[model samples]
Target: MGGYGSGRLHDGRVLCMGGPWVSAIAKDDRFVAGWVTHATRWGIVRGRGNSGGMGGLRMSYRRLYVPGATYFFTVVTYDRRPLFSDPVNVQLLREAFRRVKQHHPFTVEAIVVLPDHIHTLWTLPEGDADFSTRWRLIKTYVSRRCAKTYQPPGSASRQQKSERTVWQRRFWEHLIRNQRDFDNHVAYIHNNPVKHGLATTPEAWPHSSIHRSP
Candidate 1:
């Protein structure tokens, strides 16, 4: 029986808690089931009927990965907490992105950070579809630095795993299939702050990358 931080995958590979929960990936990069745990702001949920072991249930969702492509992402804070309402936290988020980008290069096409969520577009380098790992590192960096001040009290299960409540366990990601899709996502990212009534216009949002656009 593996606890929150570690487990064994279907193929008997060791699973490490890089992020909030562990995603068991097979040799072919497919997510398989074994000792799977999913986390929310409230607590961690293990597979049905499995109390303390590393085997049970299956993951129903599949993530799409395309090398050298554009992606749109919507990432939210745990329990929709307004952690980004403070400008300092927004700067911290930027620092995390910068730190991750230095080692794993990616282009930030567009981005907007709101009080509780963020919308952004990114372009991965050729032959690289490992955005998942990049995101894991970024989240880890932010969580390590901001957990004390921004993170709420987590559940016992989460505390056992040493999970931070900074960001949601999962984020919404979309692979951009065409130029039209990229344009639409960029527009959506810029307008999101206004839609949420955080700003009168997109340009009024100081934390967004819109001001840096040509």
Candidate 2:
């Protein structure tokens, strides 16, 4: 009934329909404000969008329906600094997760907290949409609340103690292409302590989901 245009996303996936033409594929891309360059596990990528980005790479890799997938999402502290003196920050993070559930509707399969970052596995909710906005809102709220904590150098508000932004304002995400990737990232999150020479077994890590009783 309609026409379709396509392109390949940066991640090397073939994107067929760009816009409203497709019955399944999501939109193209969303924008983030004051975005800068940040390095991710994947490598150096643009952080301008902070969250709410739409790309074939994200939508593709397996158009996982919400509730069906096991996903990996992480939010790190500013410059990787560990400074969550307030438990409220953790609340904020969980609140964001809740809100994400409200919208994208995903079940958190796993979550782990490090001094400076977190890794969470989300199961997509059936018939739901993208989870990018969820991350965007969390980052935005945290950044706005913590703005004063770390004002961009040379900015006019550098003199003030505003939000005390605890996060780096951007994060890395993956769709968990398969079971292996899912297990790998989950193990990475759980066993981070051993890798960092902090603990021996992943179950010994207190900040991770592995420590919790199923």
What does candidate 1's lDDT look like per residue over 47-93, in tens digits?
A: 12211110122334445455565667777798888988888888888
TM-score of each: 0.70, 0.56
Model 2, span 1-214: residue lDDT tens: 0122332222223333222222223233231111111223233332223342112133212222232334577767877676444566667666665665564555555677666777776654433335666667767666666556654556445336443444664565665543344456657778776776767887776666665444
Which candidate has the top score in lDDT? 1
What range of 10 consecutive residues in model 1 has the weakest lDDT sum? 46-55
Task: Give lDDT per model, in order.
Answer: 0.65, 0.51
Candidate 2: segments with Cα more than 4 A from true spot: 1-68, 150-153, 157-166
- Top model number, TM-score: 1
